[model samples]
Target chain A: MLKCNNINVKNILCDVSFEVKRGSFTSIIGKNGSGKTTLANCIASQRKYGGSISLGNTSMLDISPCDRARIMAYLPQSLPSPNISVYDLVTLGRSPHTSLGAKLNKSDIESIDNALAVTGMTMLSNRMVPSLSGGEKQRAFLAMTLAQNTDILLLDEPTAHMDMHVAAEFTELLNRLGKTLIVIMHDLSLAIKYADNVLILDSGKQIFFGSKKDLLVTDTIEKNFNVRKIENDGEIIFTV
Target chain B: MKKLIIIFTPLLCISIILGCAFGSADIMQLIGNDTDTALIIILNLRLPRVIAAVLCGIGLSVSGVLLQCVTGNTLAAPNIIGVNSGAGFCCIVMLTFFPKASVLLQIGAFAGAFITTLVIVGIASHINAFRGTVILAGIAITAVLNACISFLSLLDSDVLTAYNAFSVGGLAGIRMSQLYVPAIIITGCLLCSLILSRRIQLLCLGDAIAASLGVSISKLRIACIILASASAAAVVSFAGLLGFVGLVVPHMARRISGERTSKLLITSSMIGAILVILADLFGRIILAPTEIPVGIIMALIGAPFFFILLFKRRGDNAEM
Candidate 1:
């Protein structure tokens, strides 16, 4: 289990507590500047939190970086310029698994291959990373994260700026993956479609936490998001 | 990758030997007499310069790539942290104050680099922050160091004139002895760099990403800064200030291959060797009777290419 209690975040997430149960798809939906990304960071142990966060049975602070990396993989929302190729970028995800000066072994190569296969990036593997389109770059980063093969994934706005088609498709992809996912997303409709659990955070507090069914209904969004109606269907369409 | 380096190694050796052999004397004359002025000049002047260039090329490019890796900024180079100027200013002081003192000059330059690295690392990056302070200080010092070097160069015209040839960054009179010591220093540092390459790659994605990936960002940054400083010092001790090769060659290497530091380090080193040798060869034949410094030619060619790439990349990376 990944747990946080009475967590306070500055300039982002504040006083939010959530447990990412093992092998469950959890989606965090909130507006811009709602501290969703900050929450992800706190969980990933990228930033310090006020209270306590534990991974499995141990405090996150107690674990080694190598050990923490083995349990969690994070895909940053922003993509840095790739001065090198896609093959190299994906290879970077294997860094946590290796010790200093360790060479890439057959298992490492197999992991990279599996990630590329999963993300459908094998064809563009040899290409330079800077040359890829935005969606393609996202897929490449997804492949890199997948190559880590960690049980927990923390994504900040995984499909925030994407077009409807790609966002819908990627939601399906994340839904099918067998991992503990705590994703920060903006699209309420997409969250309802894919998330097994929904968390609505507004200005850092957890306003609502329950099944995706609660979030898809009109009442929760109206109270937390100041929105009137969302279509009552399997897929929710939030209306202002 | 191992296979690639094996193939590239012998070719580099051939290029280096050819670079070392070219000088005032014909190859035949050097073979004939071991004690002639031609032989002496070749051994003392030309060979020291060539060896210096090789070492500088390797060191500067390594430092440049490592800095870029640590900062996750392509603009990061030894110059960014003022280490180059630190080395240069140290050399200027040693030269102006103690003319004709070679051993002291090397020590002085190395000390300068070491001091600058410490000061920058101390002020800019705490043991916890990755590189906010160092980069800020680097920008500030670049202006200050350039000004100081120019002022000193004017004041110590004699030293300046004597060192002018060194400043142009050629392998003109580099002997095995002159650069061997620095090469050894750089070689040892390179191993440390190899140990940290994977960590540096994680650090390249920015501090948050590095932290999430289970990397100690501050520790890695400090180590990288020191290694980069030492690498810059090693080169500047012998070659003075060879430009563009450090700043540009790593990008070219990255463009060809990928961003793996394990791959980048050797490839960048090889690219540096090729660039220096070709530039030195150009210096040899272009003004054959009177050779120009390879540094001048490198700047002339590399500056334009560097700007173009930078501008183009700004377009490519503007969204970032």
Candidate 2:
């Protein structure tokens, strides 16, 4: 389990507390400047916070960056399009595991190959990162994070650049990955579809944290995002 | 990459041998008649010049690679971005006022280079400027530093002759005493850069990702700046603000060796050595007794390459 207690980032995020069970999917939904990314960054130890985060029983502050990276991986929103082959980019994910001056072992190669396959980017492995399309680039970076083979994945707006269909497809891929995940998303319908639990924030304050169904029943969606939640044919939809 | 290195290594060896064998003295003719003169010319004059070229080449190229990676700007090279000017300005100050403090030259140059780099970086970060803005800032600072250097030379006419030779940046009258310390410093820094190559590559991934991947972004960037400054300062101490090897050679190496830092550094060092030695040879032979500065030849080459890169990036943006 991943637990965050009273997480606060000066001016950006206020005191927020939550716990994520292992092998569960949690979606963070909020308006612009609502501190979704900041919260995720705090949990990933990418930012300073006046709180404690622990993975399992060990305090996150006690773990070295290399050890923390082995347990959790983070994918930030603004991805760079570097001029490197997809395979080489993904190979970087194995850095924390491999010893200094040591080559990748057979198992490491398998992990890389597996990550590429999981993201459905096996064929594009040889393509340059700058040449990949928007959704393809997203998957390439996802492949990198997945290759990290960590227990918890923190992704901030992973589908922000994708079209509707592509976003849905990518969300389905994330849902099927079977890892503990905390993803900040803008698309409410997709978040409701894939996430078992929902955490809503408004202007840096945590408004609600519960199951998606319970969140839809309340007026939190309407109050926070200015959208009305409806259910039809066993499908959840949010219309602005 | 191996093939690129293989082809270039031999070419570099030949350039070095030829650079040492042929010069203003025509050592070949003197070898039969006066062995002492031949030996003296080869050992005292030609050898030191060739070694200076090699050292400056490797040092500047490696330093460029480090700066480019740290700044995340391909146009960030030592000379083009005010690093060499920083060192040159300090050197002039030392030569003009504290001529007796020869032992402090290297340290002073490093301090100058490091301070200038920090200033440029500070301005860039403060404004949150883009990559091109950083290069423009560097160019602007370089012009101001150059003007200061010229003004200093005007005030102290006694330092003008020494500063003139230094300003044009040629290998005309090099000596063994000038090269020994820089050679060791360059070699040591090069090895450190190579060992940190993997971590440096991670830096290209951007700050957040690199930090998330266990690399200390601030520490790594600081380390890179220090290493790059030391290398550029060592070269500037001897070679008199040699340009272009840092800017041009790394780009050439990247084309041949891909974006891998180790391969890029290795290829850049070799290609830089060959290009500098050959440029020095060309400068020596082209004007015969007049001796064109290698800096001029490099400027002729580098300025055009810089424009090509600029337009090429614009073209790529257009394509995208």
Candidate 3:
């Protein structure tokens, strides 16, 4: 389990506290500039914040970088495609486990292979990253994070640039990963469908944090996202 | 990549042999005659000049690779990005102020290079370190350093000829003793760069990703800049302001070896060494005893190649 106590990130996020249960799919949703990405960065230890974050028994600040990397894997929103093969890119995910010489052992190679298999990128492993399409590139990066074999994954707007079908497929893949995941997402409907719990931020403050069912009944989403819910054909839908 | 290395290693050997043997003296006579003049020319003049050329080539190209990787800009070279000019300008200033102190000249050159790098980095950081912004800041710094160089030349008319020779970039009269410190420094820096190659590859993925992968981006970038500046300063202190080797050699190596930093670093060094030796040989032979400066020859070749690369890449992203 991950716990944040009164986390304040610069001037963007203030007095934010939340708990993310182990093996739960939690989606953080908010408007643009609502500090969702900032909060994600803070949780991943990529950014400095006030207050404390602990992973199980260890404080996040006290964890060594390599140890932190082995525990948590983070994928940024958008990264330019480096001119490297997918195999090499995924192998980079095993960097924390490698020795000073950076040569991969048998276990490292097996992990990379498993990551490639899981992400369905084994066939494209030899292809250069820059040559891959948008969704394929995202999967390649995802494969890299998977190769890291971390217990918790923090993804900042992972599917923002992906097509609807690809996004749905990616969400399904994440749901089946069985790891603790905190995803910052903009698509509310997708969040509603995929997330077990929701954390809503409005102008840097957490207005709501609970089960998705509880979030649906709260006025926080309507007030913060400026969207209204409507009933259509016995199904509930939200529109701005 | 291995094939390129195999092909280029022999070519480099041949170039080194020709560079040392065919310059202003008959190789057979120098070997057979055993006269003091011939011996001195071969041992003291020709050998050191070839060594200097090789070292400068390796140093500049490695510096170029590091700078390009850190900035994520293919156009970021020591020459074009003001590091070379900055060092050269300070060397000239040292000559003007302390004309007799040869040791101080290298120190001045390194100081200038380091300060100029800090300035360029400062400007780049403020502007978010975008490719265009970094290159623009580099160009601006280069212009300013060039102006400073011109001013120094005007201040001390006595230093003009020496400054002109050094600024044109050549291995014409370098002594064997001058190569020792720079050789040690460059070799050390290159080794460090090789060890850091994996981290550099991670850096190419961008800052956030690199950080998430257990790299401290700020520390790595600072180390890269220091290593690059030091290598460039070593070259500029000795070879004057040799341009284009840094700019073109790494790209050529990348095209042949792909983007792996380890392979790229080794190939770039080999290719850079070969290029400088060939350029020096061409400079010595094309005009006979008159001998064009290697820097001029490189610019003559490099300027056109740089323009071609720019034109070919124009349709791509403007960030380059």
Per-residue lDDT of model 3, residues B71-164, tens digit only = 8888789877778778878888888888999777767877888788888878877776544565788899899889988888898787887788
lDDT of 3 by residue, A88-194 (tens): 89999997787555578899999999999999999999998888988899899999999999999999988999988999899888898899999999888778778
DockQ for all models, in order?
Answer: 0.60, 0.59, 0.57
**lDDT (Cα, tens digit) per residue for candidate 2, span B232-312:** 878887777787788888888877777778888899999898888888988888878888999998888778987786666
Task: Give candidate 2's error at residue A117 in angstroms.
Answer: 2.1
lDDT by residue for model 2 (A1-240), tens: 999888888898887888899999999999999999889888878778997888878889889989888988999999988778899899899888887667889999999999999999999999999899999999999999998899999999999999999999999999899999999999999988899899988889999999877977788888767788787899888998
Q: How far is B249's C-alpha from truth in model 1 (Å)?
A: 1.7
For each candidate, what TM-score against the reference? 0.88, 0.90, 0.90
**Model 1 misplaced regions, further than 4 Å:** A81-85, A214-218, A226-235, B2-14, B28-48, B96-102, B127-132, B146-173, B308-315, B318-320
Better of 2 and 3 by DockQ: 2
lDDT of each residue in B1-320, candidate 1, tens digit only: 78758867887788777766775457666566754866666566666666666677789889988888877666777777887778777888878888878678767777887788788788775444545567777877777877887888898678788667656665654557667778888897788988888788777666666776778777788888888888888877777667777789888777655777878888888778777876876778676778878889889888988877777767454321
Order the numbered candidates by TM-score, best leading. 3, 2, 1
What lDDT tens digits, residue by residue, belong to model 1 across residues A162-187? Answer: 89899888878877778888888877
Q: Report how far residue B289 has shifted in candidate 2, in Å.
A: 1.3
